[model samples]
Target: MKFLSSLFAIAACGLLAASVFAAEQAPQLSGCAAKRQDITTQIENAKAAGNAGQQAGLEKALSEMNANCTDADLLKQQEQKVLDAKREVSRRQADLNKAMSKGDPEKIDKRKDKLAESRKELQDEQEKLEKVQPDEDDD
Candidate 1:
């Protein structure tokens, strides 16, 4: 009977440990929150790389995010901004790819500029999303 009890105790401990691990791994943010975290990480990476131009752009984007993302009523607008930024990035990527394939210097340069603009837009939207505070009810 003692051996059986010991086994049960070990099993309970294992289950508790597993539950803790699962909870730790679970994502804490949804929607804009998650996007904001991703953008923040990218901004940090850019800063670490010593890319002054990129960092400046990201900082501007972060400022824009800070301004618009905090309002509860603006959630939908922020979401739309994110979607539009994503689409712009996709479009720019496609244009860049096409330009690269064509091997045209002028086209490539123009596409590269467009791609950079799109990237900045994406960063800005992400910053906005990140700045969104969790609803009071979420707690």
Candidate 2:
């Protein structure tokens, strides 16, 4: 029993270190490969932690990815995300405007922070959309 527990602990530690190392490496995987890799990683993590439910969910996701995933659909999804992000930015800008009109410094700062966060989200979504574009064209 002790040997088995020690082995499990060592395996878990190895997985953790590998994940951290991979994250640090930050390979620029895009499109279906990136999506599949992410789901696979989650499945592995769930299995290692003995989370059967999560592992099943990830397995389903992987199957769905294998079945119905397409570059065009992915591109459209990314585009929609960018569109949603833009709308959020617009809404945040309006909130900031309203706060400015009230001339409350605290409210202004709060709105500014929210706006900044939304803007950053928008930028990140836009970047993701750009990355998806190449996959669409390659087909």
Candidate 3:
């Protein structure tokens, strides 16, 4: 019984170490490579689920990414998204201010919600932009 328990414990430890090693060995993809991987994963899922329309769309998107998706272009697009998000946040802030000035509690609450959404979008865009590191050529 003691021998069996010892073997089981050793086996558990080995499995845990193997799992950790596998996770560590997986490369952390970023930029266009990461984007490609994501789209590919989606395509595979769509295919597996028998969603022909979605699979076709994902395939088209993957092809487009393959053809025209460059690191520089991706960086520029992410920057533009961040800029647009910022503009949207500013607009929402103005709307909220207007609503507050009118002293309408309902409108103020609605505008506040809109402003929060825009702010969150801006934050998400900023995070995405950070993930896309610019090449030296971009500088």
Residue-level lDDT tens digits of model 2 in 1-139: 9999999999999999999998889956777877888899999999999999999999999999989888789989999999999999999999999999999999999999999999999999999887767644457
* Model 1 CA RMSD to the hidden true structure, in angstroms: 11.0
Ten-residue region with minimum lDDT total, candidate 3: 130-139
In the range 73-112, model 3's lDDT, one tens digit per residue, is: 8989999999999999999999999999999999999999
Instruction: Please give the distance, in angstroms, between residue 103's alpha carbon in candidate 1 and its true position after superposition.
Output: 0.8
Predicted structure 3, TM vs. truth: 0.76
- Please give the ranking of all candidate structures by TM-score, highest first, separated by commas: 3, 2, 1
Q: How many residue pairs clash in all the candidates, one count each?
A: 1, 0, 0
lDDT of 2: 0.91
Rate residue 13 of model 1 by lDDT.
100
Residue pair clashes in candidate 1: 65-128
RMSD of each: 11.0, 6.3, 3.7
Q: Candidate 1 has what TM-score?
A: 0.46
